[model samples]
Target: MEIGTLQWYPGHMVKARKMVLENLKLVDVAVELLDARIPMSSRNPEIDLILANKLRAIVLNKSDLADKSQTEKWRRFFSTEQGYPCIVLESQLGKGVNNLIAAVQELAKDILEKLAAKGRKPRPVRLMMVGIPNVGKSSLINRLAGKGSTRTGDRPGVTKGKQWIRVGKGLEMLDTPGILWPKFEDPEVGFKLAVTGAIKDEIINIEQVTLKLIHILSMKFPEALKNRYKLEVLEEDPSETLKKIGVKRGCLISGGNVDTLKTAVIVLNEFRAGKIGRFTLDELS
Candidate 1:
């Protein structure tokens, strides 16, 4: 529970990963969504192997909840350096959704051109939306399709199977269930994923994860943490900061002890809601 070793590869995730690999053959392009707040952590490295030779576009989902400056930098980093077209979008709010469509089309331009050269009619582009859980894949689909096309909740594993949903203007999307790698070798990666709600809260001890989140905030976003919690002094220790926050938010037990569980839940939920502030957990450099 103390950020030791965290492994959460449910049976369904393995099945989902397998489904993605197998279904890759049917898709014309791969659309991988990463949490704008923790872009690197949310990316599954296995995707490169799974999507070999397939044209891919990276969407930094939930961009509204992340630092806009950092999100732009990340977009450029992927587009200019990695050579993968990247779009920063808030799927729920519908910001930059149109840009995502354009990006996808651009990625498949050559294929579309080839089809035209052969005197064949242009076909609807097929894309498999891929990413770890809770990175707004379902939200993106709902936004694009303009309805509750897929069942969506804040929790993971909502979309259990791959679903084909048609969007306007020559686009058909295959919405796949979010899946994590079998093992999270780096505890930090696990911590980041857990803190960002990509990993289910049931799988991790929330108090421990909250402590790590607080530690990160204290280091990377001290001013935002200070202003949100309204603390006069930023404590060197994350536990101290958490305790202060617990006291301020009145998350206390019967004996005046800090109700860590309640405090952790509040911190995590608020962070995810962007109440504290827009933050980019993954660094560009």
Candidate 2:
């Protein structure tokens, strides 16, 4: 069967995209956050156009949850290959965040020096956080400010408005609504976003998403699945494998059949929470 492109654009997201453009004028650079587990998919394609001609520092957030080797490769790809300053970050743990700070500073070095040369006091560097929904933008802001300056939640669109907050001695950040592109050119992008909880589960069929996830995981990291699910052997059929997992985890219905929905939910949440293993869905090779 042939797969076609998938697109998801809520009316609010159109407004969000416009808001991002309006707010971009107030900031010197954008701290674009990407989910480390699926770096490519997490990136909103419109971000390149949205942040054009401005300095950008890429923050691969949730680094602790991704394969270490793949994380390093992405860092190099962004910093060396793409020539953008990039840093790995674990917003939940405060790991590799100092480097993000350094990278931002490096991005604004010339502008700072120019301000100093003009006989004016260097002002706080205004930064904007831009990313697709549920990519940890709020947590990163909180981690930087050392306080809950913005609304932090586990779901997409938690930040429905834009506001400025002081984050450091010479840093201010603009938190805007998380914006997504109007259409996903590749179908896998939608699946990847769905798998990571960026897209609302209510809008997608969880069973199908979970099936795709299982298919990918079973092919790439079957050993991790084996250990996590306690399966002696994996079957070629991903549906069969998931049923075995459902039975092991006791997601059974009244008829003693595997409760696939309940089992799928568990698999997705655990994978997002990094219980299965450190994985990189967007591997370089």
User: Please, what's the RMSD in Å of model 1?
Assistant: 5.0
In model 1, pairs of residues that clash are none
- What stretches of model 1 exceed 4 Å from their correct place? 9-13, 147-163, 175-183
- Write the residue-wise lDDT of candidate 1 on 1-285 in tens digits: 365445554776678878777767767888888999988888887878777889999999988888989999999998998899899888889998888888888888888889999999988787777778788888887788784343322323424454676777677776554454533667778888888887778878888899888888888888889999899988888888899999999999999999878988999999999999998888786
In every candidate, how many clashes are there? 0, 0
Scored by lDDT, model 1 comes in at 0.81
Top of the candidates by TM-score: 2
Candidate 2 versus truth, CA RMSD in Å, comes to 5.0
What is every candidate's alpha-carbon RMSD to the true fold?
Answer: 5.0, 5.0
My TM-score estimates for the predictions, one after another, are 0.88, 0.89
- Report the C-alpha lDDT of model 2 over 73-102, residue by residue, as the tens digit: 999999999899988999888787778777
Ten residues in a row with the worst lDDT in model 2? 151-160
List runs of model 2 lying over 4 Å from the truth: 1-7, 147-163, 175-178, 181-183
lDDT of each: 0.81, 0.81
